[model samples]
Target: MKEYSVTPNKNAEGWYVKIEDVAPTDLYSKKDDAIAEAEKLASNDTPSRLMILDENHEIVEEKKY
Candidate 1:
């Protein structure tokens, strides 16, 4: 049950879902899509945390699974 984060990618454009320290993957064209995917992944491991970040790289919301 690793913690996950959905953050915006400034360089490539789009959002990314990161699992722990490993390089973030699961790029999405929209922030909502990325958040949804992150939540789904977190759901598999109950009680995991999913952090959603804004374009400025600041955390805007946190979803608990």
Candidate 2:
């Protein structure tokens, strides 16, 4: 089994999720969406880092060691 960290970030509109420290796609509009996608990727059991951003291209959320 694989395990990943999920965190919610607050921005101008609402909260956003940053999965593993990589850039997020348009499909991810909020925290929940990012986490859902991350969950799927985590199933692969591969290490990953994601950094979700907002409309302003700023980091809204992140997961670090």
Candidate 3:
């Protein structure tokens, strides 16, 4: 199972999903959306960006999103 963190930023412009040292991905939506997106993107990776889990942050559930 993978882990992910959801952070709300007042100056960040939108919500974000941080997966540790990795570059944070701006979800530009609510926290739930960010988590859902992260979970969906976790299994898929791309050169432009990567979808991963945050070992430090606790995602709502251990399984699924």
Candidate 4:
């Protein structure tokens, strides 16, 4: 299974949607935008998981597809 995650940037000024073990390709200014992109990626890749993290880098929500 693959995994995707939405996490705040180091500066907490942007969000990133990343695939497990891979570098993020883009930065989103809004958390919701990052989450939406991650969810779409996870759902398209069945048997994948999406994790949403807060500014503190703690997992706040998770979804399996």
Candidate 5:
């Protein structure tokens, strides 16, 4: 299964959508945007998981596709 995550940047300036074991390619200014993108990616990649983290890097929500 594949996995994707949406986390706040270290500085809290933006959000990052990251694939498991891969570096993020884009940073979204809004957390919602990041989550939306991650969800789309996860849905497209069936048998995937989407993890959403808060500013403190704690997993807040998890969804499986």
Candidate 6:
């Protein structure tokens, strides 16, 4: 199954939505915005999962579509 992830940017000032095995979307300054976009993309692209990562890059939440 396809998977998407909401991960913190390197600077920790922004977030990005990444589709597994594909290029990630643009950076988002707000976590909500990033997750929102990821959900939309994941739902539209395929039956997938949305994984929200914490500051330490650990999976904090996972939603299956």
Q: How many clashes (backbone atoms < 3 Å, residues ≥3 apart in a chain or on different chains) does model 1 have?
A: 1
Candidate 1: misplaced stretches above 4 Å? Answer: none
Candidate 3 to native Cα RMSD, angstroms: 6.6
lDDT string for model 5 (1-64, tens) is 9989998889999999999938995899999899899998999999999999988989999999
lDDT of 3 by residue, 1-65 (tens): 34444555655445677664356667555556776776666545322232323334434344333
For candidate 6, the 10 contiguous residues with the lowest summed lDDT are 18-27
Candidates 5 and 6 compared: the better one by TM-score is 5
Q: How do the residues 1-65 of candidate 4 rate in per-residue lDDT, one tens digit apiece?
A: 99999998999999999999489957999988888899899999999999899889899999999
lDDT of 1 by residue, 1-65 (tens): 57999988877489899998369877899888988889888999887988887877778998788
21 in model 3: Cα distance from truth in Å? 3.8
* Residue 33, candidate 5: alpha-carbon lDDT: 90
- Minimum summed lDDT over a 10-residue window in model 4 is located at 17-26
lDDT score of residue 19 within candidate 4: 96
Candidate 6, 7-38: lDDT as tens digits: 99888899989988367778899999999999
Model 5, residue 6: what's the lDDT? 93
- Model 2 misplacement above 4 A: 1-31, 42-45
Candidate 1, TM-score vs. the true structure?
0.85
Candidate 4: where are CA atoms >4 Å away?
A: none
**Candidate 3: regions farther than 4 A off:** 1-3, 10-13, 45-60
Prediction-by-prediction clash tally: 1, 9, 1, 0, 0, 0
Clashing residue pairs in candidate 2 (N, C-alpha, C atoms within 3 angstroms): 17-31, 20-49, 20-50, 21-49, 21-50, 21-51, 22-49, 22-50, 22-51
* Clash pairs (backbone) in predicted model 5: none
